[model samples]
Target: MAVRAVRGAVQVDRDDPDVIFDETCSLVLEVIRRNDLALDDIISIFFTMTPDLASGFPAAAARAVGLTDVPMLCATEIGVPNSMERVVRLLAHIQTDRPPAMVEHVYLRGAVKLRPDLVRERRPGTRGPGGSTATG
Candidate 1:
């Protein structure tokens, strides 16, 4: 299997622990669902929270949903003037036969504007800049 990277983000209305945990889990699960990935296929996940979100660790939410053995990390997103607030983001590495072109990157809730260009929903047959194969 080839290693592929999946990216996603979600916006949280508040920094409350419950909200953060819920949103983080939802984001991770959606990524897995869209990519048709099993837990075993995930190599690791790196998460980040906008500086405004400080109530909890997004990685905890990941572990709560059966990624206990997978390596994960959490860090604060750099603070930029007027940047989107209270957002959680993740980059997951997975084993897959799909090429980057077929990979679907997700941006949900208020975070959609974070990466308008990468937010398109891509199905298995989709062709992106990476093109038709996993050659990269």
Candidate 2:
């Protein structure tokens, strides 16, 4: 057994809780499915939002999606000059046999433009943003 980590990032269009919740839920599900992860295998999930998105905790979206058993935390992303705005990033620590190099770090939506290398390098098996389609 080994420890693996995968990170995925996307931007929120609005600060409203409903929009934030829907987007975050969809994003989390995509990452998990892309990495072929089990909910129980997740050690924890950390979410960070840009300062502009301050309607509520993004972690709440995880709970709403029934990930209550998984430890979740929320924070604010550093405000760098000319950085993408209203972005929500997620870092998930998982227990698996795969190495970190094999893990896919996802960057989607507006964030995808921030890291084209990552987006382009992502495996075709990895799912993009959506319900359960594995097509990143």
Candidate 3:
């Protein structure tokens, strides 16, 4: 199997720990589901949150999603002027047979603006940007 890296990001409405955990878990599960990956296939995951997100570590959400044995790390994103706020990003390395182009990267909530070209069309039951109704 070839090793590949998948990227994902989620924007939270606030810096609440519960919001962070829910959004982070949603983002992680989307990446795994889209890429058809299992926990054993994951080599490691690195998470970085924007300076404004201080409620908790994104890695904690990964653990909540049952990634107990995966090597995970969390850090603060470099504060660039005018960058997005309350954003949590992840880089997950996994072993997969899919080609790089076939590997999916997920960007949810307002984070979709970070990489519009990579963003998947919102699913029927999925939340839209900023976690609002897609049609409204």
Ranking by lDDT: 3, 1, 2
User: What TM-score against the true fold does each predicted structure earn?
Assistant: 0.86, 0.85, 0.89
| lDDT per residue (tens digit) for residues 14-133 in model 3 | 999999999899988878887888889999999999999898888998998889999999999999999999999999999999999888888887898999998655557655445554
Any residue pairs clashing in model 1, and if so which? Answer: none
**lDDT (Cα, tens digit) per residue for candidate 2, span 1-136:** 6777788888877898888888888778777766777788788999999988989787898888778899989999998988889888998888887777767677767777767766644346645532234554
Regions more than 4 Å wrong, model 1: 121-136
Q: Between candidates 1 and 2, which one is better according to TM-score?
A: 1
Where in model 3 is the C-alpha error above 4 Å? 121-136
Candidate with the larger lDDT of 2 and 3: 3
lDDT tens per residue, model 1, 31-79:
8777888899999999999998898999999999999999999999999
**Number of clashing pairs, model 1?**
0
| Rank order (by TM-score, best first) | 3, 1, 2
